[model samples]
Target: MFKFRKKKNKNKDSQALGGLDFLSIFMRTLKLLSDFIYVVIILVMMLGAGLGLGYLASQIDSVKVPSKETLVKQVSSVTLVSQMTYADGSLISDVDTDLLRTPVESSAISQNIKNAIISTEDENFESHDGVVPKAVFRALLTSVGGVGETSGGSTLTQQLLKQQILGDDPTFKRKAKEIIYALALERYMSKDEILTAYLNVSPFGRNNKGQNIAGVEEAAQGIFGVSAKDLTIPQAAFIAGLPQSPIVYSPYNSDGSLKDADDLSYGVSRQKDVLYNMYRSGYISKEEYENYKAYDITQDFLSSGVAETTSHDYLYYSVFDEAKDLMYDYLIKRDGVSDQDLKNDETKQAYQDLAEEALKTGGYTVKTTINSTVYNAMQTAAATYGSLLDDSTGEVQMGNVLMDNSTGAILGFVGGRDYNENQNNHAFNSYRSPGSSIKPILAYSVAIDQGLMGSASILSNYPTTFSSGEKIMHDTSEGTAMITLQEALNSSWNIPAYWTYQKLLSEGVDVESYMSKMGYLIDNYNIESLPLGGGIDVSVFQQTNAYQTLANGGVYNEGYMVDSIVDSDGTVIYQHEANPVRVYSAATASIMEELLRGVIKSGTTTSFKSVLTGLNSTLGNADWVGKTGTSNNYVDSWLVVSTPNVTLGSWAGHDDSSAMSTSSGTNNNKYIANLVNMIYQAAPEVIGTSDKFTLDSSVIKSDVLVSTGLKPATVSINGSNVSVSGTTTTSYWAKNGAGNTVYKFAIGGSDSDYQDAWQKILSGK
Candidate 1:
């Protein structure tokens, strides 16, 4: 019994010791954990601090910080209003409203506006050194946790930085950059200066009038019909709240109409929030806050009917596009921007964005080649006569482009039947087959320029088939006989054009080289119908520019709308430089010009000749040259007319490529002719330079057999040589005796069949 009791007692003692040891170990572990918690907190703080410092130091040297002087200058200056005007200084439009958004000074703004904006946008604007670190920490936690967006903790200064410099990307990296820039900005600008710049640069969305209103001053004026200086407390609260969600709180729709009463709840709700913030900031008392919050802010909004749609919508696009092109050229030529970047679409887009931004905001003064007088007259004439053919089932549309041949500048254009009905710039924006009009340029010019044929060379007008079994048809049934080149062109016959093109192909002529120099790109090569406009196409502007080269004495200049652009600093950034390319010899152009004269004189454009007969009394019978084109099945109609000084190209068709009736095409032609008649009536000086065709001394203008393209061959009628005169015609020939070697091919004769043709010329057959 004693042994058992002693053992039990020892066991109890051992158990008690073990329990004490367990408690001691637990106590040590508890104390160590307590100490490690502090260490962990310290390590986290050190890591965050190290990362923040490293990021700040990394961007510090690279980030450009504005000096106080530069900040003040930026705050004081306003963007210049962009203007586009006629060469005569006639106003086209106040292109933009940079002048209307006049910046209000600190003294000019109301205290209530400052208070409302400060309380709502940044509660501690007056106290912080551009950042609120605690809010930033909360934002970082929220962002890292992915629990919310990254906009939770930006100070007013940081918001300004985001608006002006750092973009508002919802990322921790952007936030860090924003914090850095915000801190730097505070050092270079005062509190009021920062606020002023913010107010001036911030977008305030559209007003009740539905015009894009920006800046605090414009917001106040546009939303409440009150200036920023005169804004009441309610108006101030409303305007101050707009920067948070401008479009959502806007009182108007895109069409300048007032929003629905229910739809306006957002702006009203936002205004109440602004008033509450003001009350919390002690800027307004409870009584004042309630009074202004209950005051109907919508009652102050401007109320009017929807704004009327404006005209000349296409002109703006034309001017802006041409101006951007000129700017791109200037950037490449003057600023030495790398042209290799323009080859890549993405990098080229970057360069384009840069140039476009400058044009939109750089306060550029753009001068255009659009002659207001001539443009207005053409517009009026087109509208009047074009309506004669406009019908319900098929709405006829017309596009006319007039170019100054001397300068290669577009003088005027008739864009469409009505801009509201159709905004497509048919003259410049769309391309269509020019039909037989392609003959004179692609076929005849190649033949003449290559010394293949004279203007009066006889060609077989019989029908031919392509190798692909496509039949070439003629507009009239009289095309089965042999005819001179001038007759074939004037008659708008396709068989003759095909024969000529075949001859050109057989002779190894580089027709595309000639076409390219005239800016006519051959999209379809080796097509037999190319000479008849079956394979190639062009816009009225392009066709006119190409033909203008012929009128410009073989010199080609790319047509441009922008004349001279003066930057806001009064520096001429662009001056229209004539980069003339010689596409053909002056003698060749002269011969082609004379050959084309028959088109208007006695061919398809005979109606235009009647109009010219009237205008000739003023310019001492000014001669006009022109050509007409009709796409297959009358899908498109074209008429191009020119004097030595200017060329006007016209096209008429449906946007959907639907064919019109023959009468409709004729009426379109008549409308185009009338447009030219009115232009000549309005601006006769467009052709005041020269009406007579020119031929260089290197070319001989002589009489030749229309059948043989050679001066009547001498015959042995007597001892003296007698000239055979079966059928004689006048044409320009190379003085070096380079006659058309392909004349035999035109008459369905190859180079081996030359003896039969010479025998006929010798016998006067």
Candidate 2:
């Protein structure tokens, strides 16, 4: 018993020692944790202190805010479209605000107008500071979620800051700047001063006279025919609702005419909302609101005069419209204004405001390739010629497109007559059938390029029906004979063209696919569509581009108008660079150019030379090439003219598609010829002096019998003259190494035999 008790005591003592050791380790670990916490606290304090010092340092060198007077002067400065000029430094036009702005003090504007704007734009204008925290939070939340529309609860002071101090950039950085600027503006200006500035700079859509109706004074004058102080409650409310969306609720059309009956009542709902807000805000009594709401103000609006400048000359307006579109595209493409981003109302409104400001306040210089001399001549010729086609029922319409063949720069454009009276821009919008003019690009040039046909390749002019059941009639009065491909295009013989198209199809050539590569906008594909410009509709811009490919030696150069865009600060923001894509061989282009020249010499456009000489005797021997086309029932007359330097396309027709009124033996082609003559007559001396066509050496010259479709003699040399006995013609062939240099294929013979011959020719066996 004594030994067992002694052992238990020793074990207990050992356990006690082990417990003490664990306690010591736990205490030490706790102390270490406490020290770590202290270190972390000290580090955090140092970081905070460093941030505070940096902020203080930044505050020490604060940017000086502009004084109220300086701010007002900066905002009120006029912005012109810096100046648009031609390549030759000739003035085209300058864009500026057509409205007359008369700045007024807050007291000068009617109290009703002030209350109406406050109710519509900023409900807490009188109560809130420059920045509304709740609205900013809401906007931030909406932007982050990418859902729901933000109710921008901006105060009037913030709006003023955005327009007068900050710019209309919808970036977050711009928003931050706006807040800072607004706070600074509030310190330097009173509430009345801010309101005055805001009221004087707001855009209220355009007046009936097509003039910008900016500022309260101009708005009152434009919408009510009254001064700002004399505006009625209803008129004030109506004008106040416009700043949110000027275009959607515009009282006038783009042409300065009253909105059509369907859209005349557009702003009624907004006007009612403004009135309700005004009454709720205690600016007007309920009885007054009811009376104003029920007021029939139609007569008041009717009494107002349209601003006198609402009208524009067609040529100037067309060019301006095109330039504006180009500017918008540039901003969208280069500036990253994605269409998805514009879905936000605020972003869209900011863009609209910026565009207006750029027009009225942002000084920018736009340079175009238009030549004033050529433009004037085209206009004059169109006016003189169009008068003859006009009947007592309606007027005739015309469109012209002039491009530099080598450069693809649009030198001149005419959309339509009387832009103010007719706002349709035919030059860009009209998509009429090119008629037979498409024969050169769609049929002849393509046929020649495939090595299936040369300029001297013969196509029977006998009457026939196509495989697609499209019937073609050959005019025997002009003499029924086999026509060369050059003659087929020059004279525009339908039967020969149809045969050429059939042969192309039999050879398994996708004619439409080939033409598309050549930059022809073909909308439909059919066998019959190959001969004439049928089953497709194309614009003058596109037609000129296709022909320019031929002029540019088969390299397609995209047609462009704006050469460069310079901001008011003299920075070049946009410049055009040529991107030429080879669509056809140089040899093929050379041969086609020769054939087109034959057109001017003795084909459908032969009368052009006579017209040119008649217009200007100095141009008597002027070397030019072109083609003429007349649509079914003479609905459209087209002419395309090309010199080595310039290519011009003109069209005359009625917009309604009614048959042209013939002056009892009037040749419709003469209109095209006359217009082209006028354009060439006005060409600069340098153009005539520099214009020269160089033939490609790759084109082999051979004398071939048209009837047999074979070289009569093997020429020992490439350029040596070869003799042909009968029915022989000199042909310039694009050296494509198409074997079996003869096609015994004959039209009006057995179809199986011709097909067999074509199959052999295609295989090059």
Candidate 3:
């Protein structure tokens, strides 16, 4: 009984210890649960606090501190580089303006501001506190439907905030930022200051420079060419509406009257809204608003700046092309932009955003070399001839190029009939047949280089034949003729040119090598038959440089259109210096110049005769050394002239390569010559007389004579027998049938009239 009791007590103690162990386990489990709950609560509080801190940090970061230095740099008055003007201060085709922001303070500008605010955004802006509650409510309701409209319901201050702080993209984050900025702006600035800032930042239109129109004043001056103070109510409204979409609403962008119903309706509607708002806000008297509301919308709102010049001449198109090309290149490199980026919409938008950022960051200014007045004159000349020169006719497309010989500055150029109709630059880009223009260089330079002929060398114009086994050259000019090298060049005689080519070939001057030296890649060479004076290919820019070499006394100065480029800070980024290199001897170029002058005075280029008579006579009788080239079948016509001060080359041809009417008279039928002369007449006086040089009389001697492969005997009318004359005047004597001594008589009178008579004489008229 004692043993059983002890065992039972041990068992009871063991059971009690087990119960205690179970309690300890339960207590440990409860403690773990409590610790886990505390951890969960701490984690939740920490996450919440972290999120709240991040949100607050973002809000603080969004509040930008306005930098006065940045603002000064970004918003200083931009002085447009004033274009070099004529003596009379008439703008050359070039324009210059200050780049910094200019304020609009004119009464007309106030009126436009009042009108635009009322018309586009709020009819109750005067009573709003930085926000239009109704419009905001409407926008919120619209957002709920998921079809957000493009039209903004933001007040002017909000709009300014969006533009300045939030950027152009309409996004929720941007809107929030704009609201914050608007509230901040309202606290720091007056309504007028906000409005002025808005006006200064708003884009009213685009100038050729790719800059947006800033203020009402700038918009008025840029779009209408008038000051803001002179703007009419209708004009103001029209300009105000442009900020909505400048390219789309531009009067110049479309083919319609400024008073087109759509345009007037839009302008009038906007203007009325503006007036109604102004009247309600007491900014304008009820009478003033009513009177403006009654103003006729049909009347044309003419602005007063530079009157648009009309250009019908081909030369204008050529120059415009050069300018456009330069402009395109400038834009491309100005900011390291690419063509593909311009083509892609998203990329383009990105570029615009970058540009806006750059505008804020600042660094770009473009300076052109064109003279505005000269450009205008060129445009007018082009416009005058637009109807007569149908671009479709390969015979009469016009090309004009004007450059300052001394500086290599291209003053004005026109490549085609119109830039709107055709964008290809005929002046600098199009390669046209240069015709007889290539003859002077060939006759003077190539012949001398080959040791075949000298400037004063003489050759018989008598007909002869050439054969490279299969090809033959036949002289088509009537009668056997003889002419000096200079005379041959001035008259553009095919026989002399052929003979010269033959002589060069005999002297081992390969046709390709010779042409290559003169800037041509001659792929085909028919020793027996080549288009001697028939055709040659070259670009206006190349041709201009060639003539420029002659003008600069045989120095080749590369042609350039941009004078200088500067950063927004007025630091020079690019500076073009004069680089002159000798391409030919002074003697060779002088001889060529005299010969070319003979062209204007007496050669086939007699079209310039009337225009250059006075100048030619007074300036040592120095005339343009010019050449008139008409393509075979009259497909293209070219007139290239080089003066001491400038080199002007013009071409008229159809883009399609169709034939032109040769019936207009040999030299008179060509339109390019007439166009060139018009440009010369209208040229600014800054391009003074061409450099003067004395011709080396020793280099002017007439020596050797050989028949061109086309004519047989040298023909001369000595009292009518048409006797053959020797190459040199000293080698042969002349006499009439009476056996009396006869003298060589000039076939035609002054150099101006000689060319026509020579042609008639050559044709046996």
Task: Indicate which candidate wins on lDDT.
Answer: 1
Candidates 2 and 3 compared by TM-score, better number: 2
Clashes of each: 1, 5, 62
Please give, for residues 1-765, the per-residue lDDT of candidate 2 as tens digits: 000011212112111112224445445334433633332222223234445423322321132345555655555543344567787877777765565566787788998888899888888776654556566655655656666676674678777766654556665434544554554555556666777788898778877666676788887877677889888889889888888887667677666777765676777677888899899988899999999899765556643344443344555565566556666666555435567767777776666555555544557777888888887887787677756546543677777788888889888877777566667767777888787888777777777778776667767665456666656653333234555677777877777766677777778877876677756666556647546766777778788888888888988888887788787767787788898887767888878888888888784534766666676665546556677776776677777777777777777777887776543113444665566667766875524634666668788677766543556543222244333224556777775422223334343334444444444433443
Model 2 has a clash total of: 5
Ranking by lDDT: 1, 2, 3
Winning candidate number (TM-score): 1
lDDT of each: 0.70, 0.66, 0.52
RMSD of each: 15.7, 15.6, 20.4
Single out the weakest 10-residue window by summed lDDT for candidate 2: 1-10
- List, residue by residue over 298-402, the lDDT tens digit for candidate 1: 888888445444455667778887888877677555423354535656545655665665576567889988888898888889777887556444778888898
TM-score for each model: 0.73, 0.69, 0.47
Which rank order by TM-score, best down to worst? 1, 2, 3
| Model 2: colliding residue pairs | 79-361, 209-306, 209-307, 209-310, 210-310
